[model samples]
Target: MSNTLRISLIAVASAAVLAACGGSDDRNDGYTPPPAQPPVLNVTKVDGRYHHNKSQQDSGFRAMSDMPPSASPAAEIALPALDAQAQTKAQGDSLGGPILIALPQTVAQAQTAEQLASLLHWRQDAQGQQVAALRVQAADALGIRLGLLVQALPDAALLRFYPDSKTAQGYETTGAEINAVLRLNAQAGEQGQAARTWWSPDLGGDAITLEIVLPASAAAEALQLALPSISRRFVDTDSDAALQAPPAQRAGLSKERIPSAGSCNLDMSCYSNGSAERDAVARMSFVRDGKGYFCTGTLLNDAIQSDIPYFITAHHCISSQTVAGSLQTDWFFRTASCGSPYLDARRTTRTRGARLLYTSNVGQGFDATLLALNDAAPPGTYLAGWDARLNNSIQKVLSLHHPNGALGKISGGETQNYANCDGRHCRAATDGRGRYYEVRWGDGTTEGGSSGSALFTQSGHVIGTLHGGTASCSAPDEPDFYGRLDLAFESGLKNFLAAAQRPF
Candidate 1:
C-alpha cells in the first residue's frame, strides 16, 4: 500500500473534448489554456503486490501434549524501558530517528519446549470447542526468538502484528496481554486456509510487549510461533512484496525523499483550516516484500450515515483480495503543529484488516476501490462528505492526504481541463461519466503516500480521489488526475455512500 500506485506523467496524447454540454465547469472563458504540449514522460504503472511467505520448521523445538509443572518459578528478563515522555515531548522529538536494535537474547530450543509444556492449557476456542492454548507471560528472556517483541517506532502510536506461519492461521492470538487481541480466523486466497495479519491502537506508549498464543486442535510436535521481522518508526514489522520487484527508478530524485515525497511546506496546510473533516484523512502503511510502503485514503460518510467505517482508496493500492485483507490504516496521523518538522504524531487508532468491496480496472476509467474497515472508526473520527454530480462546474479544488506517510497536508489547484484519456488508454467521447479532472496545482504537490486522498471542491465537497499525475515541486507545471466521484458514486459506491437513511 505504500507509494506503489502507478503515477501517470503528462504524456504526448491527442487531446479530445470530453463534454459538449459544458457540464460542471465553473471556470471563466478566459481561463481556457493552450493545448498541452508533448510531456517529457508518460504514465507510470506499478502493480499492487502482496508478500506472504511460508516459514520453515525449526528442528530444535518439539511439541509435547503433557508435562509436569515446573517446581521452580519461571525466570524472567526485561528489555530496556523507553522514556515515552521524552520521545513525545514535542513535535521535534523523533524516537532517536528510527533505530532498529536486534536483541541479543535467544531462548534455547530445549528451554522453549519446556516453557510451552509448563504454561499451555486446553481451552475452548471462540466457538467453545476445546483446543490446546498457551499464554506466555512477558519477560525479556522468554520469547521464541531474540526479543520476540521489538520496540516499535518511539514515535509510533500503534502496533500491527502479522503472524508469519500459515499453520497458525486457524488459532493464533495476538495482543492478548495488551487486551487488543486479534485472532487470524479468516481463510484467504485459493487455498482458503491462508493466514492473516492484525493490528492494535498505540498502547499509549512507544514500545509494546506482544503476547503470542498458539492454538491447536490436537497436541502436536514441533509447533512454532513464527513472528515476522520488525521495522522502526512505523508498525510494518512484517515483510513487503514491493521490495522484491525491481527497485523503482526515481530519475534524479534523492533516495531519502524519493520513498516519501515532498517536505512540509506552508502551501500544504491551508485548505482545511484545521477542521474535523481533516480527521477523515489517514496515512496507510503496508508490508509487501519485507519492505514498508506508504499510501493515503479517506474514511467516508454514507448518505444513510450508518457509520459502518467505509474507506476509499485507489484500486492500485489495494487491488487484490490478499492486499485488501492485509491493509493497516492509521487514523489522525498528522503532526501536532502545522508544517512542523516530521515527528511521530501518528495515532494508535488503526486496523490491520479490511474487506474489499469493489474496484475498477486499472486500465479503465476509474482506478478506485471501496473497502469496509473490519473495525469501526474510533472516537473523534469524521466521515468525509462528497458530491457525485459529474462536471458540476468545479473551479478550484483542494487535496488532503499524507504524502510519503508524512503528517497530513493539503494541496490546491484550479481545474485546468477535462480529458478522456492519458497516454495509452482513452474512454469513449460520449462516456461523460468516465472523464477525469486535469488539475494544475497552485500551491503544494503529491507524492507516494498521497494516493487515494480526497480531492475537494471550493465548497469542501469531495469530487474525486487521487489517481496519479506528474505534479511535484520539481515539475510544478506537470498536471495530475483524480478518479471522478460522480463516476464512482454511480458505479459501485452509491449503495453505501448514497444511502438515504441517517444514523441519528
Candidate 2:
C-alpha cells in the first residue's frame, strides 16, 4: 500500500496568482495550463524501541511456561466488594471507569507524543524485529491503588504489554495474576485500521506493574494517557468457578502441562494448516455482574469484504447484549512449536470488548450469536471464510478452540449421518427442531472453554459452531453436536455472512 497524503493547497495558491495577473494575453497564449497535482505527505514504516522509560528490563519477566499447578477457588473477591457503584458515583456519571480522557490531535500534542515515543527503550526479538516498550507503574504519588485507562491515537496497528522485569521477579505470578493487575494492550481490529482506546488493571498497591509494548509502525501522535477505577483491574475470578489462579500467576501452557487424554494441546502441530482458519480462532474471556467466564469464537469473513471483525460463537455462551459488551478477546494464542515445552508468551494479543449483533438459544433451534468486535484483530490476524450452504456436508471435520481457556486445541472427527434431535434434522432446522452436524472424534476432545468454537470442514470452510456434546476423553465414542451454519445464514446471518445480497 502507498503511504501518501495529498494536499492541494499549492495548486490553489498558484491559481490565485494567475487570477491576480488579470488574464494577460501574452502569458495566456490562448491555451489553458494543466492543473497542478497535490503534494503528498510521505509515510514511512518505522521499526525500533520507543518509550518514556530510561532503560528496558532484561530479566525477571514471566513467560508463558508458568501456568498454575491446579485450578483455584473462583470467588476470591466478590464483585460488589470491589465498590464499583461507589467509584462510579465519585467519578460523577462517567461510564468508562473513574478516568477517561480523549487523546489530543493538535500539532503541539503530537510533538509531546513524539518525545514520549523517543524515550521508549526498544528491544529486538530473535528475528531482529524491534518492539517498543513502556513501563507502567501501578501506584500514583498519592499512594492510591488504581488502574489507568488511555485512548490511543487512531494509527496504532498493534499493542501489548507484559510484567516488567522487576515486577515479574517479585512474586510467583500466574497468567491470571498478570491479567488481573495489568490488562496490557489493545490493537487495531478488523473494523478499523487502528485501535482507539485501552485501559490498565486495577492494582491496589506497588505489587503490580507492567511494560507496555507496541509495534514500531505505530504513530507517536496517536498515544494517549488515561486512568480508571481499581475495580477495572481485577479479572473477576470469583472462587465458585473451577479455574482458580489469579490472572497474573498464569502463563502459556508448557508441554507437560498439556492434557494427556482430554483437550488437544496447542503445541500439537496437527491443528495448524497455515491457512487463515488457524489465525481466525480466538479464546474469549468475559466478566458479567462481577463474574468471569471463558468461551471460544471465530472471526468470520463477510460479504462486504470490509474486514469488519464479525465474530461467531455459541448463543449459550453470550446471548445477552450486556455480557457481549463486557467480553475480552485473545488472539494468536497458540504455540510456535508443535511439541515444544514452552510457548512464547509475548506473541498473544488481546482486546477488551465487542458489540452484540445477533443471538438465539438452543430452544429456538439455532444456538448461535454474531458479534462485531469493538476493536479489530491485530495485523496478520485472519478473517475466516464460511460455507453456509444447506445440504452441504463434508466427510471430515475439525475444530480449534481453547479448552478451559488454557491454550488453543484442535479436534478432528468423521461426519456421521445428520441426526434429528428436538424435531430437526441435519441441514434443516427452521420451524422444526434445531438441526446439527453429528461427529465422532478420531482424537482429542472439547471442554468448558471450547464452547462457541467453529467447526470446519476438510476443505477449511466453517460449517457451524459447537452447540453441545457428550464426547470427551473419558467417553471418546460419544457424539458431539454443532449448530448448522446454513440454518444461521437462513435465519438472518446471510445478510452479513453472504457475499451477495439475498432477501430473507
Candidate 3:
C-alpha cells in the first residue's frame, strides 16, 4: 500500500519513444533517461503530472482524475486515385475498424541494394560524407509486413506501404496509426524501386487516409494479428442532415442547443411504514423512532468480502437522531440483524450475523453511504447494487429502501450521471425514470422522509444518492439533486477495501 510510483518523460524528437510505450508489459518500460549532460539540461522531477521517466513513478497519476495531453495528428496526404488494390483484402476478425492494418500499393519491382544504400541515411561516413545503410536498428521495430500499395499523387509519384499495430498483429499505434505507418513504408519501397532514397521528409504530408488502394499478399495476415487491439464499441456519427435542423427546429433542442452535459428527467419515491399495529411492524424492526419503524435488517451474501460480516440498510434507518425515537444503544446495529422480539429474553438468545458495513450521507446530505460488514451477510443475501469494475458508470439502476412506519416498504428512482458541484450542492439532469420527478420538498427537494433512499440505474449500476431535488425534484432549471456519493465518499473508499484484505 505504501509503494512508490515513477514519472514519465516523452522525447518530441523520436517516434521510437512509442516503441517502449507499447513495447513491453513492464509499467516501467517505454521511457529512457537521457545521459547526464548539462546542469541546465538535467531533468528535474515535478509532482503528479506524467514525467515520462521510470524514476518518478505512477502513484501520483494512478489515483489522479486527469490525464496529460497527447501528440497532434500527422499531416494529411493528397493523391490521385490509383488502380483498385490487387484484390480486396480477405476480411478477418475485426477490431471494429481501428485495428485494420495492411500495406499501401507498390508501383514497381523490388529496390536494388545499391539503390537502397544510396537513398537511406544508413550510416555516416568517416570522411564527413553520408553513407547509405539499413536504417532500421531492430528487427522487432520493423513490425509485421502487411501487403503493399502504390498510389499516384496529384503532385508526387506513386508508392507502397505496410500495416501493423493490431492486438492480433501486435504492432504499435493501435489503429489509424497502424494504417499510417504501412502506407509510409510502402511509399518508401516505391522510391527504393526507382533507385531513389531519402523519402520526401513530409511523405507528401504528415499523415494519410488510406481509404483507397493497397498492396496484396501480407495484408490479411497482418490484419488478423491486430484483432484484439481494435476497439469493439461503436458509436455512429450523427447524420449530416441532423447537423442542419429545419430553420424553425434550429431554435428547438437541436444538437446545437444541447450542451455537452445535455439534459435529463427525474422522479422521486418516498416509503414509510403505514400499519398502525406497533408490534406488527416490530417483527421486522430495524430502527424505531416515535413515528414508526424505519427498517428491518436483511441477510446478504459473503462474496467480495475481506473476512468481514456484511448487510445493508438506509443510513438514517440505522440510527438517525431525527428518526430514532431515542438515542438508545439498542437502536443501532448490534448484530448482523435482529427482530422486534429483541432476540428473546436471554441477552444472547438472538442469532449473531456477520459484521455489517453501513453507509449514509448526513441526513441533510443524501441516500449515499457505505456499510462494512462485521462479517459476511447470511447466505443468499447480497448487496443489491455493486460492480467494482463499474466504479461510477452505472447506466440504469433502482434501489430498495425501508421508510418509517414501513417494514418491507421500498422506494427508489432511476439514477443520473453525477453532477459537478461548486460546493456542497450537486446538480444532474433526469427523465421520468422513477420518483425523481416526484417528491415535494424545500429542504432542497428530497424530504427527510425520502432520506437514505437508494437510487440505482436501470442496468443495476449504483450511480448516486437521491438526497434531494430542486426545480421539480431538487431545483428548477437546476437538474435533479443527489449526494455526490462517488466523489464525496471517494477519499477512503478504496483504502477501506484494501485494509479489509490485509488485517492486523
Candidate 4:
C-alpha cells in the first residue's frame, strides 16, 4: 500500500531515451533534470504529460507500455511512497460523482483486455459465491483514454493538483488538483478539437483527479454522450480518475539577452527571470559553472509553402513531458546569475517566440521543434546562417549559455567528451549527467540556470544544447551534458517556417 499519494507531473510525447536493455534503475535509459528529492512512484500506471518548461528534479527510471485501458493507472498496483497519508477518503456505497483523484500513470488500454482481466479476477464475493461482476463493464468504459477524462470535464470546471503538495498545509486531494479556479463558459467549437498523446515520463506514473470539479456545458456534452455507451463498466465517473493528460504545455522556447562579461554589467552569459512553478514549488535561480552558459540559434521566421513561418528550438527543450497525471511547465529560460523569474521587465527583454512546432509526426521521436509565430527575426537576432548537420559527434566545440542567472556565458571554448548515451533517440549523456564537459572547463562549468544553453564550434557553428552540470563546480565529476543539434531540423524546420509565419 502506498504510504502517500504523489501526483504525476509533466510528460513528453516521445521518450528521449529508449530502454534497449533489461530495464532497471542503472542501465535503463533516463534523464535527470536537476537534483531535488528523489521521486517516489507510489503507483505505477497513472498518466499525465511531462512539462519541459522548467528546471526539474526528475523521477527515476521505469518501464511502461502503450495501450488505452492501461492508459490511466489504478491505485491498486502502485509503489508505496516514502511518506504516508490515509487511504480511501471515501469508499463503498458512498462512491459517486466526478472523482477527485491523483493517479499513478495514465495509458489508454482498450476494453477487451479489461474485460478479460476482469473475468479472470472474478471470484467468490461476500456470500461465498460470485454474482455478476458488472462494474468492470459499465457505461463510461468505452472512452478509457486519459484525455477523455479531462475532455469530459468542462473548461469552466477546473482541475488542478500540485505535485509538491505533500505537507499538511499543501494538499486538498491527490494527483492534479482540479479546483475549478476560473470557470470558462466554453462552447464546443465547430469541431471539438481532438488530440492524441504518446507520452514519456518526466516524473513517474501519471496522475488524475476530479473531486471538487465544476459541471459541463450543454454544447460540449461528449463525456455524457459517451458515458452511456461504455459496455465494460469497471471505469466510473464516480471513482477517482488516474493519470490524465497533462494540463499545461509546460516547456516553451523564448529569448533572452547576452551581456558581455568583465564589463559594467557583471560578467556572465545570458539572463532571464521567469516562472519556476512548473519545475519547483515556486521560482528557482541558476547560474553557469564550467565554460559557463554559451549558445547560439537562428531566431527566425521564414516562409514555408508560401504562407507559414516560425522560429525553432531543439525538441527536447520545447516538447511536453508526461508523468503520473501532470505536466512540468517551463515558459522561459534562465541562469543562476538571475534570481526568481521576472525581477524587472527592463532588466530582461523578452524575445519574440511562440507556439512551438516539431517533427514528431513524420516518423517517430525526432528531437526538433518550431516556434510558429507572426514576426520575422527580431533585431539583434539572426535566422539560420549555418549548416544544420547530422549524426556525427566531434571534439572541440564552442559553448554558450546564460550564467550566474544572467547572460553572455557562451563564447568560451570548451572541449567535451562523448559520455554515455540514452539510446538512438537522445544522443549524449554525462558521467555527472551534467558534467561530461567538466573534464575541460575548470571553474566555468554550467550552473543551475543554464539548461537549454547552446554550444557551438570555433569556426562559428552549432553543435549542442546544455542540460546538466556537476552537482556543483568544485565537485569531482566532469558534469556537463549537451543535446546534439543535427538532422531533421534541416527540412522539418523549413516546413514549420512556411506554416507558422503569419499575421496574428
lDDT of 1: 0.44
Q: Highest TM-score: which candidate? A: 1
Error of 3 at 176 (Å): 68
Per residue, candidate 2 scores C-alpha lDDT tens digits across 1-504 of: 111111011100000111100011111111111123222212111111111222322222234234121121111111122344544453342221111111111112112334445555455445343444443332221111222233343332323333323222221222232222222222111121112122332222222333333335543444543322222332222221122122343432212222221433233334344244767778776543333456789887765455567789877566654455546676666554454334434344444456666665554445677887765565556777777666444367778887655556777776654543331222333433436666667656666567788887756677787765655666655566677777776666655555343111
For model 3 the TM-score comes to 0.27
Query: For model 2, what is the error of residue 458's alpha carbon versus the real structure, in angstroms, after optimal superposition?
Result: 0.7
Ranking by TM-score: 1, 2, 4, 3
Count clashes in each candidate, considering only residues at least 3 apart in sequence or on different chains: 21, 40, 94, 153
Best by lDDT: 2
Quantify how close model 4 is to the true structure by its C-alpha RMSD in Å: 19.7
Per-residue accuracy of model 3 over 357-408 as CA lDDT, tens digit each: 2243332333333433222222222233322332343232333332221122
Pairwise lDDT winner, candidates 3 and 4 = 4
Cα lDDT for residue 368, model 2? Answer: 72
State model 2's lDDT: 0.46
Name the candidate, 1 or 2, with the larger lDDT value. Answer: 2
lDDT against the true structure, each candidate = 0.44, 0.46, 0.23, 0.26
For model 4, state the Cα shift of residue 210 in Å: 9.5
| Displacement of the residue 242 alpha carbon in candidate 1, Å | 25
Return the lDDT, model 4, position 408.
Answer: 35
Candidate 4's clash total is 153
Q: Please, what are the lDDT tens digits per residue for candidate 4 over residues 340-413?
A: 23222212122112333342221132333344432222222223322344424334443443332334333233
